[model samples]
Target: MTNPKISLILSAYNEEKFIKKAIESVINQTLKDIEIIIVNDGSTDDTLNIINSYGNSDSRIKVINQENIGLGASRNKGMKIASGEYITFLDGDDWFATDAFEISYKEAKSKNTDITMYQMINYDDESGRVYENDWFNLNNLDESFDNIVFSPEKTKNFLFDLSVSSCQKIYRNSFLKSINASFPEGIYFEDMPFFFHVYLKAKRISIIRKHLYYRRKHDASITHVVDANYLDTVEAGCELMRRFIDNGFYEDYKFDLIAYKINGPRMALMDIREDAKKPLFKLIKEDYEKIKKTKYYQDYLDNLGPKKKKFFLDILKYDNYTEFKKNNPEY
Candidate 1:
């Protein structure tokens, strides 16, 4: 048989409650010529059994049962074995809009882009409501530029503005393979670095305004549960900035990288307990102080947007929340 047009990799760990819905959503996609590779990462729940039930009935659905590795490793396993022209990822707890793959596949083909990105709606399970991710809305180009194909250099600023969620876009399988892209095996925030790697390696990327992905907002999700592992985001962001410098693309991407560095600690504080906030912020602040001494630091700050510059400067000045907030009222 011919390989499928797109390969959808779904990674899950003990997500029995939402696994069925997520699987069914894949089956209902408007794009039929696709393969679904589900990696059940040591799910203690009935997630493996549920995946088996579907895999038994559908030829397109393939399931991999493994010991509880992290999400990045599971996704890597799925991608290594994926047999499709294009590749995309899905969280086992989040479902996509019906035509997501169809639309993204067509766009990638027609525009000849290495990646095709679209917007996502954040679904609130408790409220049973869906809303556009405010971050995504900020990256939307004016109507005149809707459905535009942009070079990575052209969209450097927007890379920071747009959602870096892996599931928000579809990538050419060859493009990913050519770059030998893989997630950080045991990390919580692997997507951040992985996302940046893709953009940096790709020549062209296309963006459309359509909301193709639905990201469920629930406390139990990995992102919502704050712990030491949550610091992975800070580590990921720093590593991403370091990569830009090593590749000599730091100047072009410095503003966005600085923006990421500042916002990461702020967002981390929101989910973390009060007791952990101060220490975490202090670590971030000290790290930034060291980064500030680098030659590229001034260049990054010089290119930063006015508001972003103020927030970053404020973060550098104050480690405590009260002082930070007092000085940066606009936040």
Candidate 2:
């Protein structure tokens, strides 16, 4: 009846093709003191049967069957049901390196940190080519953050640079509940706001330089999809802005917020559906217009290089997708 060292929450919605390997990865972890909580988010395929089969065979595996909620809500359900020292997430479409828990748990225990961040291995389904997730790339970072446990306030410089993906970090169970950390339900970028809220409040955060998880980027996953759901990014941005202002961290991370506001939508623009551009652009415009009146607006823009400066200029110029295409054409 002793609690496990880690609770690995697997969220799935018709991910039958990859669920088996995902389950096996946890069942075969180098660290055996772990509990596997599988949340079947109303999967119409054989996902439920496969999950039940694994649950029946393994005493440590716990399965929850529910109507389709969302990635955020499913994780919330798992967090409440989990009884472990620490909690981490694994998408049913992804698998972990066998030693993932062994390494991260050791770090979390030794450092006594609220959260331990690590790297992810992104593999293409068709090409079978593997590459490190860019979030942990040192060249992109201003400093080395390996094997260190530090407070969030002292390390505010790299706040926005970190990935919001929940799977990249292992969180102490009590610490997470203390802050009431929960992802925003029914949204695509649910992790964005949740990450900022808890990270800003965390007393201790640790970083690991090695790739500990494997993330599959197949066509069915959200990353490759081009649809209306991309509009959820706008709502996520708005929610994070509110959290920043209300939580008293707005002044400290104003530029970081601005930078993400400008760059985040631009990055998504390249992949969002053609018809979805105008509304997204309008929301971006409204957000940026308020930024224009701020005294530090020029200071933030002055620091940007030539290409980014031009990109912002184009963004500020047009409120409509047709006008943007007429002027820039290149995008």
Candidate 3:
């Protein structure tokens, strides 16, 4: 009945296939003083039934069912009701290493930090192979982000680049609540903005280099499937950049970071259907125009070097890149 030390929030939507394994991973955690709150986001499949079975068996498991809200909204809902000192997220389709909670909890407590981030093992569902060793390790910097400044001169450089996935991190509930930080509702790239906001605000953060979170790469996941929702995520990234500019942090460093963020979604847009391409391109063009007006525009253009600069120039010459792709065939 007492508040738990950690809360594992799972935002599920039609994830019946992997819910059991995800739950079992938490149940088998080496750390025991934890509660698992499963937010069943109006899953039409057996996801809720599977979660109910676990709730019946384990006193630590709790379930909340609501109409279909996106992942961000579900997480926000869970955070509002979470009764733990520390919190972490687990997607329904992904499973955690058995010691994830044990390792992160102890490290956060010992270090007395606002956040503790662990590395991840990305699993390829098709080949049944492990692609990489550790995904979140950056080359330079300490485990904590206590002294990272957001000013133009300081922000332009890669002070920190390894904050990748949301599930790979454990956060102090008090810090999260103090910043009034929750995943932004109704967005596709929910993790990036949320992670950026938290990392920028953190007085202290810890990074565990060992790979503990297992991310299952499936075709059905939003990251794999391209859609209008995905374009919305790209727009959200632009919005974040605009926020940085509004706060007087726009510089060559910040612009490069925004460009880097935009680049992934742009590549993903290539794999989307032909019909979705035009509107997405228009949105990207609008974002690009906004970037061009910033003081860092020339620096961003110069820093793009040869390859990306050529691509951007080509897109500008053609009005859009899809037309060029159509003409070139080999592109």
lDDT of 1 by residue, 1-331 (tens): 8989999999999899999989998989999999999999999999999999999999999989999899999999999999899999999889988998899999999998898888888888889898875675535455645667777766555767666789988999999999888887776888887888888888888787788888898978777678777767667777777667766776676666777766776677666766776677676777778878988678657876786676667768886767875765443
Candidate 2 versus the native: TM-score? 0.88
User: lDDT (0-100) at residue 31 of candidate 2?
Assistant: 98
Greater-TM-score candidate between 2 and 3: 2
Instruction: Give one digit per residue, the lDDT tens place, for model 2 in 159-200.
Output: 787787889899999998997888889898888998899888
Score each candidate by Cα lDDT: 0.81, 0.84, 0.75
**Model 3 agreement with the true structure over 251-317: per-residue lDDT tens digits:** 6345466457556655756677667777777776676677678775676676675656755555555
Steric clash pairs (candidate 2): none
Per-candidate RMSD, Å: 3.5, 3.1, 4.0
> Which prediction has the highest lDDT against the true structure?
2
Ranked by lDDT, the better of candidates 2 and 3 is 2
